[model samples]
Target: MISTPPPDWNSYVQSGIHQPNLPTIQEINKAEFAPNVIRLGTGELSPHLFPRERMKQIFHRLANLIDSLGYEEPKGLLFLREQLSKYLKTIGIEASSSTILIVSGALQALQLISISLLQRGSTIFLEKPSYLYSLHVFQSAGMRLFGLPLDENGVQTKMITKQKKRQNASLLYTIPSFHNPTGILMSEERRRELIDVCEQERLI
Candidate 1:
């Protein structure tokens, strides 16, 4: 049997260099030369808006359920999942707790999906000028990234058609409603056409 080269492992380690530093709000505010800074970089909600007393009470109740905190299920707390299912059903989306895979956040959700569905050299269609972090995630997964241009109404379906003509695309990644960065929503007609195209192309 031919010898395989030692796994090129170093290539996969995320480069720590060039990473930006994130200072806490208090630290930044305390700086001697602090300018009028309005932070829009992070997605944290306003602290003032959080119901701290209610949250404390909820946590206290949860802590009292057991002597020591137990390892939560990998999928997440079953009660939370059931609650989410009920909430989704209220909004007309049919979902079940068993079918849901709870993630820490949206980034983890995307990462998990990418690892499960994508392969090295697979082509992924994304909206032009889409979320930078998502683009980075796809790059890390070794996907061949392709862009579909957008207009006032959102991602131009015609661009997707043209791109598909040029190369075989595996999946069309979209935000559709309140798209990140641009916050543009896809029109109903475009949404219908996109669904049709996906069905015709057999892309999930």
Candidate 2:
């Protein structure tokens, strides 16, 4: 016969406050019975694809700058900012270095945008089956979210057109090119229509 554990010890062990869910990476590494774990769940690029030689040179250069190290400007490194600005211009986004607020990645960029723009109870529009991470960010910001369905072209612009007739939407979040999951691109006509709707609604 086996002895049962104490009630208080059981309660303590079951308490979720102290024992939360592990991060995806940690959980993946710790799993005892995973078979051929091709982890496409995380967005991390494969290590084999990285530019190892160039990264080594970049790290060496950054280490050399330690003597002049100070709190970087809130935006980020000026050289990187300028380089990003030039890159964006090449893609037709047309932005300046000063306008950029460099964050760690797209997740941080979405969080910053949500925090800066959303107010509690404000409504925002999103494409159906959108980025789960961005949805979480907006939810944490206390914004009301509504999903607009998508099709072969892109987000259902008809929904936006309809929404404009009634309540004001704070923002419209979309992945216009190579959309996540669906991998569909927004047509030029739809892009123009979206811009026009945003302009008409004065939402931007």
Candidate 3:
């Protein structure tokens, strides 16, 4: 099968699709580092929250797998995916190993998805005042971005139908846990509502 061309990727930004930011780096630095610091740009967990000991144990176990470290299949290790699938089961997501794809990070996953499905004129819906605005990956793939309004509970699900029709969005991007810019936690009801609406609209 033929592959997508890798050239002219930057041309999208050059065409002025760059996501505009609110302020300059100097302004952010001055405010963030002022002697009278108030709040951070975003919330983050302290080092204590990381599973360092568990990670160390995992690395120790994986040390023997060095011989198999060569580039593997695109779907990632089936064993790891199987383990993850079991873990996700406890959270009500009945996923199988076949559905799990381990990418380098969320950004790479987004890049791959955007390149695969988003056309030049297509749009994707995300939350207003979102972390996506700080990224150019979707825009770099020539996707128009749409911001859905959110409240204290989370994304305003009521507006989804209206905006989907207006923007003709094919995907909805979200960072539910510890949302980057605004840390508003999505409620369980809203989560279900989002799923229902997406299902009705046939959105990804």
Expressed as tens digits, the lDDT of each residue in 1-204 for candidate 1 is 999889665554544212232365346535623445544433456668899999999988888676546878798888889999999999999999988788888777877777788776788888887876677667766677888888888888777767785768878888898787677888998899888877877766
TM-score of every candidate: 0.71, 0.70, 0.70
Q: Write the per-residue lDDT of candidate 2 for residues 94-184, one digit (tens) a residue.
A: 8999998879888788777777877767888889888756776777666778889998999988889798556678888898987875778
Q: Rate the local accuracy (lDDT) of all candidates.
A: 0.75, 0.78, 0.79
What is the overall TM-score of model 3 with all chains considered together? 0.70
lDDT, candidate 1, equals: 0.75
- RMSD for each model, in Å, please? 7.4, 6.4, 7.6
Q: What is the per-residue lDDT of model 3 for residues 1-204, given as tens digits with 9 covering 90 to 100?
A: 999978785666467645544467447756865767754464545456899999999999989877786777789988889999999999999999999999987678888888787777688899987774335788777888888898887888888888788888989988776677777888888899999999998889
Candidate with best lDDT: 3
Error of 2 at 183 (Å): 2.7
Q: Number of clashing pairs, model 3?
A: 0
lDDT of 1 at 121: 73
TM-score of 1: 0.71
The alpha-carbon lDDT assigned to residue 118 of candidate 1 equals 73
Stretches off by above 4 angstroms in model 2 are 1-35, 54-71, 86-96
Order of models, best TM-score first: 1, 3, 2
